[model samples]
Target chain A: MTVSIKITSPLTNADVEKLRAGDKVLITGVLYTARDAAHKRLIELLDKEGIALSAGKLPFDIKGQIIYYVGPTPAKPGQVIGSAGPTTSGRMDAYSPRLLDLGLKGMIGKGARSKDVLEAMKRNKAVYFAAVGGAAALIARAIKKAEVIAYEDLGPEAIRRLEVENFPAIVVNDAVGGDLFVQGVEKYRGTGND
Target chain B: MRKVSVKDITAKVKELCIAAACHLEPDAAAAIRVASEKEASPLGREVLAQIIKNFEIADAENVPMCQDTGISVFFVEAGRGVELDGSLEDAINEGVRQGYKDGYLRKSVCDPLKRTNTGDNTPAIIHTRMVEGDKVKIKFAPKGAGSENMSRLKMLKPSEGVPGIKGFVVEAVREAGGNPCPPIIVGVGIGGDFEQSAILAKKALLRPVGGKNLDGDVAGLEEELLKTINGLGIGPMGFGGTVTALAVHIETYPCHIASLPVAVNIQCHADRHKEAVI
Candidate 1:
């Protein structure tokens, strides 16, 4: 039962700095959902739009906002949304640097990060958080509302805007080059199973 | 001769798709529980706890446990004594269409090159074998790609032998790390041709979690690999702990004397699969 640091979205540089790898946080605010497919589309959208950050071509403002790497199941009758969970982040590595350049503050996903993505995060002062991989049913409880905002033609991979409440996540990689995945492994390695 | 209606097959498969999607089987659930108590990392323990609760929540709510319900895969044992009145494959695909739509499971199948979604999660990947029985046995495994994409198959030289198989399987899991979602179940297939070996690896996953191969040597390899994989400290969701893989299952077949084929199919903790005799 870890006491999580409660925070809201549109996190500032101070908010990102106060966090360290492995610290649990509960986020209550708006989050945008995107996966590899949506990410590719976004980068293409940006490249097409040129140097203007908010060239009016973008779907939503990327500045200081977090993009959760997820493609969730469909909602049933009387349900806000279906099983929503974090996907592997490595899949989004190729396009992340471009997003980071635009002041994207945080990312939520599972698995390890690529070196390029890490370097970009460091340069842009962003953070990476991880939600439990298979914990979709439980994770969905924290999401109060979800609506597709872009790429609806992508089906489940469509980008969506979500209003979340007390969403649980663990900071995996911080702007200071601290990574929970690396640190956790080093601590337990060669300790052997008991 | 027994007449097996495709309708019954369709009905059964429909039910199986929903069951496999929403529920976590007993073995998987129990393995996570065992890991939770022994998990060396507090964060790993916490993750394991969430997995346990996630399954329970899905079961109670009758919703899918994970967003990616997976590509519907089936292993069918069609009895020699039974005669099918219609196309078995068509029935299976129809079931998938209904199951995915009605179950609210995500339609994840897509064209490989064009990258266009099929909209309905069909046509299923079916492996049918003729067996000596009056009833048909269907086993359903909706494979999530996070783990499926990480699965690998290799053609080894005959001289590489058991050591080669062991090394490849362990290396695959290491490379996959948390991508497939640990603590994972590692399924190893050996001795068959390239495609057959891949199927053997996947079929191995349909076995009861922690179940050993009947071959004594194969079973030994499974135990050894299980221990080595757990030692990697990938832990639950790769946050690092002692329990990386819950089990390692191996299935083998006789292959060419000149070549040794091995496949490793990694399965996440969700491990949604079930079987029925109709």
Candidate 2:
């Protein structure tokens, strides 16, 4: 079995440089939750703020942070949160580049990314990780705490701040443009019916 | 003749909805464990392991296996002799409403254009068929959008034949790549009108995890497609590995000479489904 590397979020370039696609990692620190609706709103906020000729400020700082593309269920009583898992990331491709350019260091989600978003990640030294899709209840356990930071009216689609511990994920895209999905598939492809 | 109560149907659907969320159907669960053992890529194996572990945790804690508890979908086998005291449709919708509420499952249904939350997760997509038996069968499958969004439909010319069907199915999985979540179940519907094709594709998903089409030729195709998909190496969660799809299920119906309609419905590793007969 390949061993997992332990890493903290708010990752620096040096940390990102050492990572590669297919490397298992356990993340510990703060992760911001946002899915389709939240991503759209964040981009609109950026645009409006930019138009005002003010510091293109956001509800939270985008620098050195990771945005998790997830819209979790409402928590049960006496629970921190409900089954919280990553939604497909491809849906957010349209809005992701803008955030990545603003110094966002990483993202956690499932599925492949669009070309533009991926190029943006490589250009900006950001990384993409894949959490097991539909593995929400298990993933939620790593989230020690969660609270809505913005866009509360969107409910599950709202943006929230999560404090996590030993959050498991695998690096799918790295800063240097290594893609596990591509390489892995090519490796086994046409090694026919094996 | 069996007299199935409308309230009973509502009650059963309610529990099935909740159980479907919290539990990963046993066959799918077992398939993942089997896949984990044979996944060629270490990363792929890791993903399968996590999927299995997630279901176990969800089962024990009675929490949803995934947050996107899915858009509630049902297939009902209404017996010809059974008399319903009330509206069967209303009972099913009410059951979804109460289940999503009481179970704390996500209310994902929304108005397409208006994008408004239905609030109660109502108006389930139900397909009912009357059968000869006196017993009513309710099969519930909560479909997560992650996989459903990848589904596709096509009307092939009669010339496309079996090769055409196989080619289309393989290409659909290829294009779908890791998005539908690898280690997926490919449900292919052939030989029906456009809408019926789509429905058959979905109904194909309700088959037991490792089950095959009874027709010998169709069953042969299922095996071949499984090998080819696994060869794609989309692996588990599309991180690349040897096991891209757990199974490919094909359901076919007779169609017009000039037209062949095909639809592909992809189910992610979660594969949440349940059924009960009354």
Candidate 3:
């Protein structure tokens, strides 16, 4: 069954585990944005273990949060953000397992995740959600507010905190190991059955 | 010399860029239309419909077809008598910069090392060929990163032959799964060395869907590959279905006897490409 939720500022890890593939979600909450470069930094901090976060070496706490895989276009005047959409998820495959291990929960992006990341999601009771790729302008409207919370040097791929209301996404994976992409494909595969 | 100024070249290149990004080619458009009907799976059909809608919104609103907007790639064929009266490379680069800016498309080009976004979308990957006649034909394809990232090239043994090529492409697509966006068009480049094979694979993407290969042998091979790729059950968006691949285009050239190079460049349903001969 399709499900949508309203999330307030700062999502909890528990809330993320409730998502599963094949379930449509309308998320209303504050989610962080980070792409390849930011993800690299995030994992790098994680690699440092407790040493980084203990000394305030890191930028933000990833526990019980959502990160969007996006690199938006430059915004015009009077705009908080530009056309923001998900980048490919596989590019972040190497870093995702590390993030998942660090208490990260929900992720918003397009495309499929790597097997390693999926395994991580299953193990940690996390979820990966997909917003429609390329529907940037439409997706951007879902953002009620936007601000660069970290990684400003990374430009458009910087880490951002986005307050979104009714942002649409479909859960691509769930804690129980159900994969929406795989199941969706199987359900719609043109064999003898439709 | 034609004495084309930077402004003229930039304008032309920009035209090509915007045209390629905003509009879907006829064959690709047609393929999506067909997929909507032939797709037995309701979900597959729904995805195809959304793709078609994407094309419409992209064109109507003058927005980019996809947010990735893609790396600027120009396939140029110059006429025998034509001469560049400006900085050809600079003009092309300027065109890309302006096109992305004016079109509101994303700037995807970056320093591979620094990983810094170029901001202007410069340094386009330009391929030039001198051919007969007094015209410059430019084909611009704003290849999205998703599909481009999924591309692969394999150097197989000559003895492996047709089965090897088929196997490699199928494996590549299966591995790609939903990453490249399925209901894709597969471009195959065969018979060239490593670099040449990669270029050939990209060049093959210029061919119209359902277009026959120039050589009958290659055409037959393409058909076989198409059948096999569809059989992978990748379906639309990797959802299992019969129409995983809309078309498989093959381009072949003579190569050294010792090498069998095959490259596969996959294009998603949003195949934004255009060509102009001037």
- For B163-186, candidate 1 gives per-residue lDDT tens digits of 888899989998998889898899
Candidate 2 global lDDT: 0.89
Badly placed stretches (over 4 Å) of model 2 are A51-56, A192-194
Interface RMSD of 3: 3.8
Q: Against the unseen true structure, what C-alpha lDDT does each candidate score?
A: 0.90, 0.89, 0.77
Question: What tens-digit string does per-residue lDDT give for candidate 2 at B1-278?
Answer: 67778899889999999999998888999888888888887777877888888899999999999999989999999989998888999999999999999999998988998787888888899999999989889999999898999888999988988888888888989888888877899999998798999999999999998798999999999999898888877788887788888889999998888899999999998898999897
Candidate 1 chain B, run of 10 with poorest lDDT: B227-236
Cα displacement (Å) at residue A161, model 2: 0.4
Fnat of each prediction, in sequence: 0.70, 0.72, 0.29
Winner by DockQ between candidate 3 and candidate 2: 2
**Residue B165 lDDT in candidate 2:** 84
- State the lDDT of candidate 2 residue by residue for A1-194, as single tens digits: 77889999889999899999988899999999998888888888777767443324787888889999888888999999999988899999999898888889999998899999999999999999999988899899999999999989888888899999999998999999999888988887865342
Better of 1 and 2 by DockQ: 1
How does model 1 score by TM-score? 0.98
Q: What does candidate 3's lDDT look like per residue over B1-278, in tens digits?
A: 44345577678888888777667677888987987788776656656665777677666755566667788888888777777776767888998988888876778888999888788788899998888877788888888888888999988999999889888988898888877877888998998789999999898888887787978988888888777777666677665577788888999888889999999998877787877766
Candidate 3 lDDT score at position B90: 84
Ranking by lDDT: 1, 2, 3
